[model samples]
Target: MTARVGVVTFPGSLDDRDAARAVRIAGAEPVALWHDDADLKGVDAVVLPGGFSYGDYLRCGAIARFAPIMTELVPAAASGNLPVLGICNGFQILCESHLLPGALTRNRSLHFINRDQVLRIEAAGTAWTNRYTPGQEILVVLKSGEGNYVADPATLDELEATGRIVARYAGAAPNGSQRDIAGVANEHGNVVGLMPHPEHAVEALTGPSTDGLGFFTSLLAHLAEGSPLAGAPTG
Candidate 1:
C-alpha cells in the first residue's frame, strides 16, 4: 500500500500545496488536513509545512500552536505513535508547543534570509532523517525571518550529547542558529523541526537540488519495516 502523508493547511499557510506535491512526487498519497480539525484522517505521518500561519501575529507560530489539530498531534507525537516533521514556521510551532526543544527567534541579521544551503546530517537515527547518513551533506532551501534557534546552555549541551542535533549548517550559519544547527529531533526520533525547507527542495526543475526527497522516502521505508515508527536509523 502507498504510504499516506498528511500536509496540514492553517489559515495563512503558504506552502501547503507545495508540501503535498512533494509528497506525491515522493510516491505517497497526500492527504489534506485542516488546522481546525483534530482528525489526522489516518495518515501514516504528518508534515507541518512552511508559512506565516495566522499572519505571524504574536509570534511566528504562537497562534497556530493552539490550533485544534495540534491537540491530537501533541499527544500522538509524544507517545511516539506518530512521526511529525515541522519545517520553517511549522518548526516554530513545534518549539512553541514544546514538542521540540529551543525557540526560534528573529534572525540575528534582523532580516528574512532565503537561499539554497548545505547541511550536514549529524543524527541519522530519526523518523524524518533516516534517508540521510550521519555526516553526509545535502542541500535544501532555508527561508524565513525568525529562524534563529536558541535554548539554555545546559539544554544545548544535553542535545549535543544525546545526538539530537539532526542537522547543522555546512557553511556560514544563515540565521545564527545556535551551533549552526539546522534541525533537531525528539528522543524517540519521531518528531523533528528544522529551519530549512525540505519540501521546497524536492523538485530539481523548480529550484535547488532534490536532496529533500529523501525525507519523504525515508518515512515510507520506515512504515514498511513493520517496526515501531521511531528510533531506527536508515541505511
Candidate 2:
C-alpha cells in the first residue's frame, strides 16, 4: 500500500505545496491537511512545511502552535504511531509546541540567511534518517530569519549524549545554532525538526540536490515494517 503523508497548511505556510509534491515524488500519496481540521485522515505520517505563519507574529511559530490540528498531532506523535517532520518555520512550531526541545532564535547576525548548506548526520536511527549512515554528509537548502537553535547546556548535553542531535552544519555554523546543530529528533525519533528545508531539495531539476528524498523514503520503509514509527538509537 502506498503510504499517505499529510502536509499541513497553516495560515501563512509557504511550502505546503512543495512538501506535498515531494511526498508524491517519493511514491507516497500526499494528503493536504488543514490547520482547522482535527482529523489527520489516517495518514501514515505528517510534514509541517515552512512558512511565515500568522505573519511570524509574537514569534515565528507561536501562533501556529495552537492550531486545532495540533490538538491531535501532539498526542498522536507522542504515541509513536505517526512520524512527524518539521522544516524551517515548521521547526519553529515543533519547538514551540514542545514536541521537541529548545527554541529557534533570531540568527546571530540578526539577518535572514538563505543558501545551500551541508549537514552531517549525527544519528541515522530516526525513522526519517535511516537511509543515511551516521556521520554522512548531505546538502540541503536552509532559508529563514530565526534559525539559531538554543537550549540550556544541560539539555544540549543530554541531546548529544543520547544521540538526539540528528544533523549538524558540516563546516562553519551558518546561524549560530547551538553546537552547529541543523536538526534534531525526539527521543522516540517519531518527531524531527530541522532548520533547513529538505522538501525544497527533493527535486534535482529545481533544487540543489535530491538528497532530501531520503527522508521521505526512509519513513515509508519504517512504516512498511509495522514497527513503531520511530527508530531510536541502540548503543
Return the top candidate by TM-score: 2
Which one wins on lDDT?
2
Candidate 2 residues lying further than 4 Å off, grouped into runs, are 229-231
Query: TM-score of each candidate?
Result: 0.96, 0.97
Q: What TM-score would candidate 1 get against the native?
A: 0.96
Residue 111 in model 2: shift from native, Å? 0.9
Q: Superposing all C-alpha atoms, what RMSD in Å does each candidate have to the true structure? A: 1.6, 1.2
Q: After superposition, how far is residue 82 of candidate 1 from its true place, in Å?
A: 0.3
* Candidate 2 residue-wise lDDT, 1-235, digit = tens: 8899999999999999999988999899999999999999998899999999889999989999999999999898887777999999999999999999999999999998999999998888888888889988888999998999999999999898888999999987889998999998887888899899888889889899999988898888888877663348432
lDDT of 1 by residue, 31-65 (tens): 99999999999888999999999999999899999
Error of 2 at 191 (Å): 0.4
**Which whole-number lDDT from 0 to 100 does residue 139 have in model 1?**
90
Residue 30 alpha-carbon offset, candidate 2, angstroms: 0.6
lDDT of 1: 0.88
